[model samples]
Target: MSQPLSVPESHPRPALIVVMGVSGSGKSTVGAALAKAISRPFIDGDDLHPKSNVEKMSRGQPLTDEDRFPWLAIIRSTAERVCAEQAHSGEVKEGDRPAAVVVCSSLKKIYRDILRGQHAASTKMPAEEDTSEKHPSGAHLPASPALQTYFVFLDGTENLLMDRMSARKGHFMKASMLKSQLATLERPGEGEDGVARIDIDATPEEVEGAVRKAVKDMVGM
Candidate 1:
C-alpha cells in the first residue's frame, strides 16, 4: 500500500525540509527513514521526475536548467500542498513550521531559490485559491504555510560515491554520472540556514539521529 502524504501529528508550523545531493548521496533512503522516524510524510523528488528526464540521465546526459525547471516545479508544488493543508487546519499557529521532508537534487543555490519562491508565492495566496496549476503539470496543490526549509547535504569521497553507484542496479543514473554530479555540486555554505552536512560513511541510524535532531531544533518539536 502507498503511504499517505501529510503527517497526522499536530505540527507547530509547516516546514519544507529538502534532503538533497547528487544521485549516490542517499537522498531517498535517508529521506524516507527520517520521515518514518519523525512520523512525517516523505516525498521522493526523484519519483516526481518524468521518465524522459530519467532516460536522459541514464544516457549520461547532464540536465540543463531548462530540462530541470519543470521537475523542480512538481516537487515544490507537492511540498506546498502539504504545508498549505496543515496550516489551513489551524494546528500550526506559526506560519513557518515545516510540514514534510522533500528529497530532491537541489544542486545549486539557484534551484533552492526557485523552490523557495514557489512556496513563498503559494503561501501568500488565499487558502481557498489554487495556484499550483501555474506550475509544470498544472496540477492543483493546497496552499502551504511560510515554509521552514532545511538542507541536508550528504557528501563522500569520489571513489566512495562511484562504488555506491556501481553497485546499484535498475536505476537510471549511472556510475559514470558520478563525476559530473560531483563536479557540478555546489555545497551549501555556513550562512545558509538549517544546513547540515553528513559524511556518507556514517551509519544509517546515525544519519537518522542527526536529521531528527536537526528537524526538531528547527521546528522546536
Candidate 2:
C-alpha cells in the first residue's frame, strides 16, 4: 500500500479519468470502483460501440481503426458532456473534486490523444472555450471546463487476461482475440502526461485504491 496523496486547498475541476487496458483487464470493474471511491460517474465505453462493431467482435473479428472512430467519438462526447454537467451543478465547491470515470480499451496512442482533447481533428467541442456564450439564443449548450484527463492502465500477464476473458459471459469480445488487443496496446511512455500503470495481479479493491492515489497525485487532489 502507498501513502495517501495530499489534497490541496484548491484544485481544478472536471477530472476526466479513463480506465484503460486490453479486454478482461478488469477495466469496467475497476472503473466503477474508482468512480464510487472518488464520488464520480462511470461510463462504460462498450456501451458506446456501434451495433456493427459489436456483431463483428462477437464473431471473433478484431476491429479496424475505421470501425472504432465513431465509437471513440461518442465516448469523447459523453465524457465532455458529463464534465460540463458537473461544472453547471452547484455541488462542486472551490476545493471539491468533480470527476468522471470512463472504461475503455484505449490501446493506441491516437485513441488516448482523442480522449485527452489533444487531437486537432476531433469533432468534440473544445474543453477550454465556452461556446454557449457565443450563441445569441440561450439554449442550453455543453461547455466543458479545461479538462484534466488521466489514464489508469491496468496491465496484467497474458495468461491472466485470457483466463478472465474466458470466464466472461455475454460479452462481444472473444478470449481468442486477446492477442490482437495486446498487439494493439501502446503503453504510456515516461514523458506521457497524467498516466498511471497498475498491475492487475492486485485485488480489485487494492487496484481501486492505487487508482485513486494516482488520480490524486495527477490532479493535486
Candidate 3:
C-alpha cells in the first residue's frame, strides 16, 4: 500500500475533492474517510438534494436534468463557501492545508463543469475544445476564491454494485435506480483535470488510501 500524501509546506491553497460514483459505489463511506484522513470537512451531497428530488428517487424514479440543476447549485455554493473559509483562515501550515471533501454523484460532465465554475453553454462546444477556458456561466457560482477541484471516481462491476445497494437500508435512493445512475455516468476523460479513478472491489480502507494517493499526485501534495 502507498503512503498517504501530505500537503507540501509551501502549498497553502485548499483543495476541493469530490468523491463521485453511482449509488452504492461507497461514495459516502469512502468520502468521509478520506476527509478525516486529510483533516478536512466532509459534505454529503445527498443531504443537499431538494425534498422533491429525494421523493422521486425514493420512488425508484430517475431524476431529470432539471431536477438535478437546483441540487447541484446548492452543492456548488456550499463547496465554494468552504473553500473561501479555508482561504481566509490565514497562514495555514503545509500539512494543515484546509481541504474539503464533498460526496457528490457529479456523474455528468456538465455537472462537474458547473462545480468548476465553467459556463453551461460551454457544454455545447465540440468535445475537442477546452471548455475550461470558456466564460463563466454567471449562474449559481460564487463570486470569488475559486476552489481547485479534484475528482475521485469509484468504479466497480454492476453485479457488485447491485449487491452492495441491496444490503444498504434507510436511504432515499433505491437500488432499482442504480441502472439509471450508471447509464447517466460519464467517466472523466484525459482532458478533464485532476481526476482519479479507483476500483471499488477493494475494501473501503484500501479504496480511501488509493483516493488519498491519487489526490496527492494530482495536487503535488
- Top lDDT model: 2
Better of 1 and 3 by TM-score: 3
Per-residue alpha-carbon lDDT of candidate 1 for residues 1-221, written as tens digits (9 for 90 to 100)? 12224533444545668888898878899889887876667887767665556779889787777667656655666776666566566545643354678888887876776566543442232334333433333323332334556777777888877778887887767666677777778888876777778788778788778777876776554
lDDT of 2 by residue, 59-168 (tens): 97868777675566656656665655565564456656767799998999988876776553543433443324322222122223356678999999999988787788
For the record, the alpha-carbon RMSD of candidate 3 to the native fold, in angstroms, is: 9.3
TM per candidate comes to: 0.73, 0.76, 0.75
lDDT for position 15 in model 3? 73
Residue 161 C-alpha lDDT in model 1 = 76
Off by over 4 Å in 3: 1-11, 50-62, 94-96, 120-145, 169-175
**Model 3: per-residue Cα lDDT over 86-191, one tens digit each:** 5455434544556679999899998887667565443232334222222223223332334577889999999999888778777655665788788888989999
Candidate maximizing TM-score? 2
Instruction: Please report how far candidate 3 places residue 96 from its true position, in Å.
Output: 5.2
Candidate 2 lDDT score at position 176: 57
State model 3's lDDT: 0.70
lDDT ranking, high to low: 2, 3, 1
Query: How far does residue 47 in candidate 2 sit from its true spot (Å)?
Result: 1.9
Candidate 2, superposed: residue stretches over 4 Å from native: 1-11, 50-62, 122-145, 169-172
- Quote the RMSD, in angstroms, for model 2: 8.5
